[model samples]
Target: MNLLHANDRPGEYPASYYAATATEGERFAPLKGQVTADVCIIGGGYTGLSAALHCAQAGLSVVLLEAHRVGFGASGRNGGQVGSGQRLEQDALEKLAGKDAAHAMWDMGEEAKQLVRDLAAGMGLPFHAGVAHACYSDAEVAHARRYAEKLERDYGYDRIAPLPDGLIGSAAFKGGDLDMGAGHLHPLNFALGLAKAAAKAGATIYEQSEVHQITHGPRAIVQTGTGRVSCNHVILAGNGYLAGLDQKVAARVMPINNFIVATEPLGADAAGILARNVAVADTKFVVNYWRLSDDKRLLFGGGESYGYRFPDILKTVRKPMLEVYPQLRDVKIDYAWGGTLAITRNRMPCFVRTHPNVVSASGYSGHGVAMATLAGKLLAQTVQGQASGFDVLAALPQPRFPGGAALRWPLLAAAMTWYSMRDRLGI
Candidate 1:
């Protein structure tokens, strides 16, 4: 099944809390006739929108095509926590790509975080301050402390502090690390702002323009449902929905479904869920993350499914939310939604030049809010013929899945089931 249409309707956003609160903006017309541009972007998520914004600012004529509405996928439906560093920890990165390269990666991550902060401030979007990493086991607590110290001593990042006892009311955790530099925001609002900024910078964005194929050549042609864009360069930023667009990318980057739910406003009792307004993510293989909405409702994300169709969202998420905060057992669920996000085996974002003029980046794991935005900037830089930073990210290992896209899902499902079972058994 096509992930793009497997769980959601065409040209419509999911019934997500984010969609309900999204800022009003222009509904870009769908691409119709033959179009030409300096850059043809084939997705309207963070990576595509950020690339459009930067490329437009650089004086490039751009046309962005989206399968559905902008931010209809994980870009808008996520938990919204803008965590720090690469998806993998610093020490893990050091092992994967030497000490110097890993340090470079850390600096890149810092830049990504700052870029989001700057963009949010300019757009008047809320960028809340901290993200607490809650640990369940004592061993996990010890590691959180060690990791905090490692960041301070080796990376010069001193924004993290350890907490012996976990979050405020949730007794599910023992202790963890709180990073002041990391935080959360309204994800859909942020995405809408990016689209608006890109359009304001002179980039033409076309909604409901589902790209089916790309005719690669000196000047590549991006063919969509009712239109085609012939451009000097093409960027594939469809993420989870990019299966048929490029097999090379699909080989390395595959889609996974994640679910989230929003609870009825807790009003005066919201502080009991979390005293400070910070977001909390626990150390689980299939992680549990949550934060308070602007109006005091709990917005929690949990569970993972490796299927084309989504499981029951409210049922899937409520169980885990209760595991974290059992007090929320009787609270009403205001909204529940699911979205597909891509992930690589290494948990690193994949950056590749499919063709000399076609660049594709995806598989951010769960760290796309900041890194995906940065990937777009780097994509634009590469298109502008200055690829120093892009080169660094692209140089990292991007191993193709053993069975390719067609068979990888089943294999992954089996492996993930084992791991999730381990998480249940607390190994």
Candidate 2:
């Protein structure tokens, strides 16, 4: 089944809390005739929108096509945590890609955060600084502290502090590191703001324009159901929602479903759960991430499914939210939704130049909020012939799933089940 239509209707945003509170703009009409541009961007998520904005700013003609509404996918429905560094730690990156490359990647990661802060300025996005990496076990806490120290000593970055006895209020956590540099925001609003910025910069955007095939050549032709975009360059920024548009990306970047739930306004009890009002994400195979919404509702995200269809989102996520904040057991869930996000075998992003003029960036794992935004800028830079940063990301190895596209989902489900059991057994 096509994931685009499996769980949600075409051209409509999911019934998410973000969609409810987001300040949506007028929807752009879908492409119905032949169009041409300097660059054609498929998928109107953070990556595509950012790329469109940057490319337009550079005087390049840009056209962005979204299968549904802007930010309808993971960009709108995520937990909204703008995390620090690559999905893999710096030390691990050092071993995987060497010290010099790892250091370069770290600098790019820092640039990613700064780019978000710069873009969100005066955009009315609910941007906040502070994200606590909560650990369940003492050993895990120690590892976090050591990693923070390594980042300080080796990278000269010291925005992180260890919360040993838990953060300011909760006793459920053993210890964790609070990164003041990283932050959270209203993800959907952020995406919509990017769309507005891109449009204002002269990039033409079309909604409900799903691409069916890309005819690659000297000038790539991106064909939709009702129209086509012939451009010198094409960017595949669809992430998990791209599906079968490209077999190369589909093999390396597998999509998985994650669910989130929002509780009723907690009033004064919000501070009791997270004293600092910072986002908290635990160290589990299936991570439990949560933060208080602007109106004091706890937006908790956890639980995963391997299939194209999502499980009962409310029931699936509520079980884990209560596990983290049992005191909120009676708190009513106001909204619950699920989103599909791409992931690579190594959990790092997959950036590749499938063709000289065709660049595909996806598989951000769970760190898409910041990285995907940066990927767009990098994509624009690559299209402009300044590709050092994009090259670094593309050089990182992204192995395809062993079972290929047909059986990869079952294989991944089995492996994730084993890991989730380990999280429960504490082994």
Candidate 3:
């Protein structure tokens, strides 16, 4: 679990095209001594920084502490696809929450996509608008078509179009759902922009300031290595890094590791290879998602783990990438690394208050990029005396991953293996 101390350090940024393309400017120094604010946020990744941005813009005094540099967690290492929905599909949600609530959930997901696009465009950041779900098999492709059609017919939304297999012939991706409204971008760039915006809006962000302890009272005191922050309200937006902060939230949301590998530049012919420059993810429970970088390198991600330990990320990732694109057998994997995401058993995010003045939000599953951003805004709104939307999210029931904490991993692994086997057998 101590990834930094392992061999991943040398190859962490090994010729990563993203690292070369997006060199973040002016690293924020860590917190020193002690200070106070209206709100103190732990973790400088998406959730923390996004919360800082919204709260600061609302004219609240905010202080953010990061265990490491900004965008150092899953936010910086994700596949960069701006998918428009929850971790669960519409049909699955409808069954869980009923029709009315399910429709509301769908609207929120649409809003999430718009929120990402609006922020990036308004801030003048680079982004593309062609995210999709590429079907791997005929049955999966039919399911995609049915899903898209139902959305259009029942929900009055036509954002998703079914791409015929003929159009995607011989491509790594067969045909699936083509969503023009959804998009992709450089995730680290997006995260850094949010941090900058938050700072500009008067939020104090401290990097390399890890919160080791929390003391809740009239004012919450967040203790870091060299400093402590006392604030009227505290938000735990650390996601997987929230180790032992709150047992209640931690028990409900488990940290699962997922890895991605970036290939060398494939030149102008890359688009010809892909047919369209859209982000594509398959229908498997453990999905494989891939997208072309702005510079034309293929960034492929697939491997996942519920275990606390991280295996050889590069070696583990290569097998999955080659499954769809055996042509890439010769393609050199320049950069390979893993990120930890908080996944609830129900696959829905959890918004529970662990302390009177402190609230915790995690368990976005694989959908944290947008939900984390939205959660930050909602957390700030809740702290500002408006708590309706926050309550709506918090009301969602999340069952603990079956089996107690110790056995959760083995249990999830076994269940996931069964589903993966079913998928392979086309059952």
**What 10-residue stretch in candidate 3 is worst by lDDT?**
5-14
Q: Write the per-residue lDDT of candidate 1 for residues 266-369, one digit (tens) a residue.
A: 99989788888999888998888999999898999999899899998899999889888899889999899999999998999999999999998899999999
Tens digits of per-residue lDDT for model 2, 298-349: 8999999999888888899988777777888888999999999989999989
C-alpha TM-scores of all predictions:
0.99, 0.98, 0.93
lDDT of 3: 0.79
Off by over 4 Å in 3: 1-16, 164-174
Backbone clashes, each candidate: 0, 0, 0
Error of 1 at 349 (Å): 0.3
lDDT value, candidate 2, whole model: 0.91
- lDDT for 60 in candidate 3 is 89
Off by over 4 Å in 2: 164-169
Q: Clashing residue pairs, candidate 1?
A: none
